[model samples]
Target: MKLHYSPTSPYARKALAVAKHHGLAIELVASNPSQNPAHLLAVNPLCKIPSLETDDGVALNDSPIICEYLDHLGQGPKLFPAPGPARWRALALAALTDGILDAAVPRRGQQAFPMDEGRSAMVGRFQSAMSRTVDALEGVDLSGPLDIGKLGVVVALGYLDFRYAQEPWRPGHPKLEAFYAEQMKNPIFSETAPPPA
Candidate 1:
């Protein structure tokens, strides 16, 4: 399997971490979407990072889809729970954390442009969404064997730490802070952590 990815992308990091945790043998192909790389464009016209070319010659895009596909091929216990309340709970939490990434990643990219009123409003909205979502995550149960939800939390917090350190999210969210600290000890996170910004 080949994975086209950016090391600093949190979404790509999620898929990479999952593959590592499962001990899957995958080739890492570094790609920059901005350059419109031919290989990536061929597999994914959207030109997204973390596009996976499976052994079956199938192409998969989107981090969640890629992660689920990798989970199916992995030898370890499943990150995605089977049909049940557990599955719903895990999916819900994953959605929340993904929401954080959705808001944050774009906001960070928008920083390259001038901060006009419209852009500033969008940034404010992104900040509000991230703040509210993190607050909601604080009271949730972060304790569990590694699952999609927990994995999402790890990636989401790591992205914030990597890209938004100046904003400091650790003040009142002790549970989240502690959960992230503990999860970081896992090799999936420790080894695949984004480089220092």
Candidate 2:
């Protein structure tokens, strides 16, 4: 399997971490979406990073889908749970974390443009969403084996630290802080961390 990815992409990091955790052999193909790489576009019409090309010529796009695919390829425990209440909870958490990433990624791009009320308003809205999400996460139990939801939250927090250090997200969120700290101890995160921007 080959993974088309940008080193700085948090979404790519999530997929890569899942692959590493499951001990799946995947070739990392460094790709820049900005350049509109023909190879990437061919596989993913959206031209997104973290696209996975399987040995059978099948292509999987989106971080969650790619991670789930990689999880199935190995003998390791599943990050996504089987159908049940646990599955719903995991999926809900993953959705919240991914939504945070969704808002953040575009906001970063908007930063390249001039700062205006429109940009500020958009950023403010995202900040509010993040704040609420973090608050909610603080109350949720992150115990038991690591799952996709936990991985998603950790990666999302990492992305915030990497790109939005000015945003004070850790001051009051002790649980989230501890969760992130514990996850960072894992080599999967430290090894695949994005370079300083």
RMSD of 1: 0.7
lDDT of 2 by residue, 1-197 (tens): 99999989999999988888887888999999999999899999999999999999999999989988888887888998989999899989999999989988888888788889988999888878877887788888998878999999899989999988998679888988988899999887887888987
Which parts of model 2 are misplaced by more than 4 Å? Answer: none
Cα displacement (angstroms), candidate 1, residue 33, comes to: 0.6
What do the candidate models score in CA lDDT, each in turn?
Answer: 0.94, 0.89
Residue-level lDDT of model 1, residues 80-100, one tens digit each, is: 999999999999999999999
* Each prediction's number of clashing residue pairs: 0, 0
Instruction: Please provide TM-scores, in order, for all candidate models, with all chains considered together.
Output: 0.98, 0.95
Top lDDT hit: 1
Clashing residue pairs for model 1: none
lDDT of 2 at 63: 92
